[model samples]
Target: MTYNLNRWQGYGHDRLYVNAGSRKIGWIDLKTGRVKVTSPAGWPSPIEGMVQQWLASNGLGHLRVKLKPRKRGDEITTQEFLDRIDRSRDDDQQPAVALSIKSQRRRSNAGTDLAKNRAGSAAYAAAQERSTWWRSLGRAMGMRTEDQAWRIGAEGEQIVARTLQWARLRGWRVLHAVPVGARGSDIDHVLIGPAGVITINTKHHSGQKVRAKPEVVFVGGAAKRYGQAAQYEANRAAKLLTAAAGRPVTVLSAVVIVGAKSVRGSRSAGVEIMPKSHLLVWLLFRRRTLSRTDVDELYELARRSTTWQPS
Candidate 1:
């Protein structure tokens, strides 16, 4: 019996693709001279196109790469396929699976709610009435209000640009505001190294006030009670990401919550929440703790970690 990597499940399917080959994974279509490849639904482009740019370490760039197709004579059984799936699933993956499920549900619910509120809240009833159909054309489908999120994200972009500049002054290349996934909201500042990838989540809530403890941080003035949400979210994001990545994607949860009074000190629920001022220094110093292999891996992983669904 022969085995196959089930593109759908990302693991071996319960049943082997027996008689399916000696199958061709990728081949140059004889008539058209076009490359024909097998790909999973999750990927947008063809497999050949997707991995075309695949490169190994050594500061080398993308060279033409392709997957070798299977021979047409192989065969595999159902039991064998299930066994392979079990064999492939590592123990560390459980956490990432859980995290992905949670995130998926949260965003799913948020999108559903947004769909329910189609009418815009403008000043006049006439505008609301006239805009009903157009309002239906636009709606949020995420946990955070997209508009506010973008504005806040823009603030974050500024902080990243400034902080990255500061880091650059100290000889660091922190890729700021790059997307880890297709969603525009899902972005992270990345530092790649042998120790793995460290993705930073930046939040800018200026002039609120700052109070901190290891378990949580409170950033606001009045009856202000900021929970450990940001830190928790960061930690969760890291864990989930590591799992989804199917490798040891080391993640460091961080928050740069800007506020009045040039904040000082450091604390985390399980992360490092600090001022934007501290980010450059912390990252610069942390650079010493990693290795060259880590740097390369981090850079690649940062680019690949983005996950998205096709509409």
Candidate 2:
């Protein structure tokens, strides 16, 4: 069968995708020469030869040495398979499992409405409270304290949740105040959509400037571990979802700063960083990486309270 080759230049490396008409067959990583085939029909006989010829013609023959070919009938996990869905097509096909997902979402939403696991609920619960009436009055008088930090953090998460309403209207599913691990920690927001899964860390630094380096972020000149925390959460979520789905799921991370006067950074130290205002635009414009079917199946697995509990 004849195939087409397309090259996409990414952040640091380039990818050569092999497609059979509209279906994505696989891709060749130009830097590593590692070939990954997602075709269920198995490795086609002519694909390797076609790839070799394309590389040679395009002056990428050096990558030939690193090529590791897979045997016919080799299978990839469900997660990898879903991630390999065609990016160019806006296919709205739903997975068979989606029928049950609708019920699950209804239950999850019911729980959310009761504030059982709603957005910012965890942060709001964790916020320190003034024991004395006088202390509450002191806080009302513009006192700065640890309680204030948590208060604003919860508010920031709520703001981001409102913004994510925009995402839901665009066919994306979002979860807020996801409880993670057994340490009483929680993820601010989790987004599932055409752009795949993302764990968002929301920070509110009202009237403060936020700056980021590759690995660290600064809020009002105070360095914080937002990047590392977000990446860690993404990794954990990926592992949990992969196990539940019986596949290798991939997750992305992002840090959204709310109420910041300005944001100065671009690179994601394993996570994307942006102000809350840009979150919607960034998510809406990202290349389509998941289909309606993929999103539904994953969201089905993610919304379960059991999914986040310690194993």
Candidate 3:
């Protein structure tokens, strides 16, 4: 009653080895329900009857079983055959449910740290009693408070999020302030839709000129690694999502400059730089690369905080 099963590498469909003792007597084409007997010359009638009965009980009685010559090295152990069948079945089945992600309680510490620094600076100035007037003047001129940096970044993220909200109407899903890695690094926004997944990095420079040229971005008059950072974020997101999806997931990178006096750039270093007003239009008109199913699965993976955290 032992069975030796082996996958038919030649066949394009599911093929199971029907074994008796240590020999392969036949192969059952599970997909077509057509059984082929390889060693029919001395095959036991009882074993054949049993196979036929099993197939009939399995609603494959309509299939015709025929005799054929045995191929070399077709014999395999019962356990091996069973394992092969199990793997084949697993490969054919789709996931019954989506992965459940646990909610993360961690909030952004960057904003809090900035606020603390601002408070500390003001207290230090007050204690000095001499530089207090200059510090107060600096504060009035927007120099004493370093918290403006965080506030500006947060404002840019909010603007990008609001702009991306239009994507929901177009069957897209957007996740804002997605935390990544053990460090405080985060993707400002992620958009998943028919066009594919895009990781957005927001830069807010009010009334400042922005310029980008292949691998370099300049805000106001200072150079920054905005393009490189966007590319890195996109790559990290794609890797995490590919693992979660059990398949390849492509991710694109973008940089949105909010309230910039002017924007001038092409896709430099694989990251697109543009004003916030154009983000929605760019996303909406890109060539569709994902279907509705892909969008749903990718969105689920992107929304999961655990996906980006190190194991």
| Top model number, lDDT | 2
Q: 178-286 in candidate 2: lDDT tens per residue?
A: 8877888888888899989999999888899989888788878888878888888999999887877677789999999999899999545767889998999999999
TM-scores of the candidates are 0.44, 0.62, 0.57
Please list the Cα RMSD from the true structure of every candidate, rounded to 1 decimal place. 16.7, 13.1, 16.7
Off by over 4 Å in 3: 1-141
Order of candidate numbers by TM-score, starting with the best:
2, 3, 1
Return whichever of 1 and 2 wins on lDDT. Answer: 2
Q: Which pairs clash (backbone N, Cα, C closer than 3 Å) in model 2? A: none
For each predicted model, how many residue pairs clash, with residues at least 3 apart or on different chains?
A: 14, 0, 1
Off by over 4 Å in 1: 1-153, 166-173, 178-185, 194-196, 222-227, 230-246, 287-289, 305-311
- Compose the digit string of candidate 1's lDDT tens values, residues 202-298: 5666566676666556565332223255444445546554554454444565666654455544765666667777776677666464454245333
- lDDT of model 2 at position 114: 20
